[model samples]
Target: MDFYLTALLQGLCLSGIALGIYISMKIFNIPDITTDGSYTLGGAVTGMLLSNHLPIGIVLPVVIIAGGLAGVFTGLIHTKLKINPLLSGILVMTGLYSINLSIMGRSNIPLLNYTTLFDSFHFIADLNWNSLIVLLFIGTLLILLIGYILKSDYGITMRATGNSEKMVSALGVNIDRIKIVGLGFANALTAVSGFLMTQFQGFTDINMGIGIVIVGLGSVIIADTFINWMNISSIWISLILVCLGAILFQLVLAFTLSIGIDPTLLKLITALFVLSIVSLPRLNLTRN
Candidate 1:
């Protein structure tokens, strides 16, 4: 039961990242590889700042802005420079590798003994309620914010840009601007997630973001599948499915570990799970 609860908390942390990716992939219709770098970028910046005794309140927004800036760079390369979105994302991600290294000044940053947002929970240590409460608070705030964004006019423009850039342009909307804004917002959310994750885990590894895009896509796919995409009604429901998908994914992983599964095989299992979900719809189509 303790493990399950722990996994649930971890899932909430991961769900933030998944939501960010969904904004880019589903809402913006852009295959963004920049998440691989931006995720760690957020962690590195947050961890370094917090280690230097910066307040969590300040560090959070700074890391989010930093991630947004990274996304803008990628968007500019794609929209202004006429580069393919996929290639643009790859280039930006590759560049961020060096950028993240420079920010951390090392391969990793340790947050041991550092006072973080979670440290305030020491007052309630008798109940051991800090981490769970914090996770739920952050998760709920993010979901509400995302839901609000998806209902706004700008959000509709973003969706239009994703589905048909030329059509949006024909309608007098600056598609380039929409792409940049959407990408920036998407990465900002990802950064916040990374910030929370590092503070919660007490360390930041440069390679922590590896395979993050896959994980994000897997969560979205799983959620959409379970919720029956056609039945999705509002932004709130979409956000809920995304969160549930991430939590369920983590639960599966926790169960596998409890059964003595090799840690190295975990990636294989994740890949298989994603593959199965992705293939299910196609298989059904063929059967029909």
Candidate 2:
């Protein structure tokens, strides 16, 4: 039970990344492979900054900006150079692999001796409550922030761009600018998630982001499947479903591990789970 609770908290803590994935894949209709690398970029930047005695409050925003800039570069390649979005994402992700290495000066950074958000809640550590409490706060804040953004004028333009670039452009909206802003925002949120995750886990590894896009897609697909995407009457509800889906995914992982499942098989399990969720809608359609 304790282990399950821990996994649940960890999932909640990483909900920011899931939300970021939702923005890119669902809101912007972009399948960004950059997330798998930018997540590590966030951790590398945050861990390096924290090691240099930088305050979390300051370093956190910087990490997010760094991630955003990475996304902007990818967007530029796609929009300006006519590169495919998938290929552009892969190119930027490949570049970030080297950049993250350069930032850390190594493949990983240990945060054992550094102060972090978890340390600030040391008082609750004894009770095993801090992780859950902190995750709840961060997850709630992210959901609210995303909901607000989705309702804003800029957000509407972003959605329009995703729905129909030609229509949005005909309406005098700068579709390229919308794509840039949307992708930038998506990567920034992903970076914030990476920063918070390193703080929680006490270490950052360059390869930690391996298959992260699968995990994020799994979470989003699970949310859409369980809630019946059509039932999501508002953006807020959709965000909440995404968070819940992440928690559920973690719980499933925890359960599998408890049953002596090989931990290394997690990526395979994530892929299968995503496939099942994605096929659910089609199954219903075929049955009808």
Candidate 3:
């Protein structure tokens, strides 16, 4: 029971990353790999600040800004230098490895002895359950905020920019600027996941974000599956489905572990699962 509970909290923490990936890949149609680096950057920033006795209020915003900066850098490289978006993301992600290292000044940091945002509340009987509650509240707030943004005028334009860049440009909109803002917003959400996960696990590591993008991609794929199957047209409904996808993904992993799957093989299993999701639609199309 405790194991499943932990997985639930973990999924909620990572839902932010799923939503961020949805923005970059689904909404903006940009394969921004910067999420790998920016996620670690968020953890690095949070760990460093908390170690120095910083307040959670300040720490959260700063970590978000750091992540946003990484996205903006990738956006600038792609837009200004005319680099491919994939390569631009790669460059920024590569640089962020060093940047995250410098920020932490070490490979890992443990926060078992430090106070975290989750410590502020003591409403639940079980400590782990209490943290889960807090994470639930935070996750709900994040989903609502993102949903509101997607329904806004600027967000519509961002979606338009992704759907038809030439048409958006023809409308006299600065498509490049929209891309930059969209990427920045996506990365900021991803960083929030990093921050929450660091606090939840009571430790932060430089390599903790390695291959995290795959997990997020899996979540987005699951979300897309539901959206297509249900014919979901509302932006809010789509975002909610994305959150559900994140939870379901984690639950599936938990079930795998419960069934005695080797931890070493978990990555392989995850990759295979994502590959199946990616290929199934195309397979259906071929059959048709």
Q: Kindly give the stretch of ten consecutive residues in candidate 2 with the minimal lDDT sum.
A: 119-128
lDDT scores of the candidates, listed in order:
0.86, 0.85, 0.92
List, residue by residue over 88-185, the lDDT tens digit for candidate 1.
98998899889999999999899988998788555456322678787788889999988887888887778778788888899899888888988998
Q: After aligning candidate 3 to the native by TM-score, how far in Å is the CA of 64 from where it should be? A: 0.9
TM-score for each of the candidates: 0.95, 0.96, 0.98
TM-score attained by model 3? 0.98
Candidate 3, superposed: residue stretches over 4 Å from native: none
Instruction: Say which prediction, candidate 1 or candidate 3, comes out ahead on TM-score.
Output: 3
| Residues 7-109, model 2: lDDT tens digits | 8877886687788888888887889999988899899998999998898788988998999998898888889999999999999999999999999998889
lDDT of 3 by residue, 69-105 (tens): 9999999999999999999998999999999999999
Point out where model 2 deviates above 4 Å.
Answer: 122-127, 227-230
User: What shift in Å separates residue 53 of candidate 2 from its native position after superposition?
Assistant: 1.4
The local lDDT score (0 to 100) that residue 110 gets in candidate 1 is 92
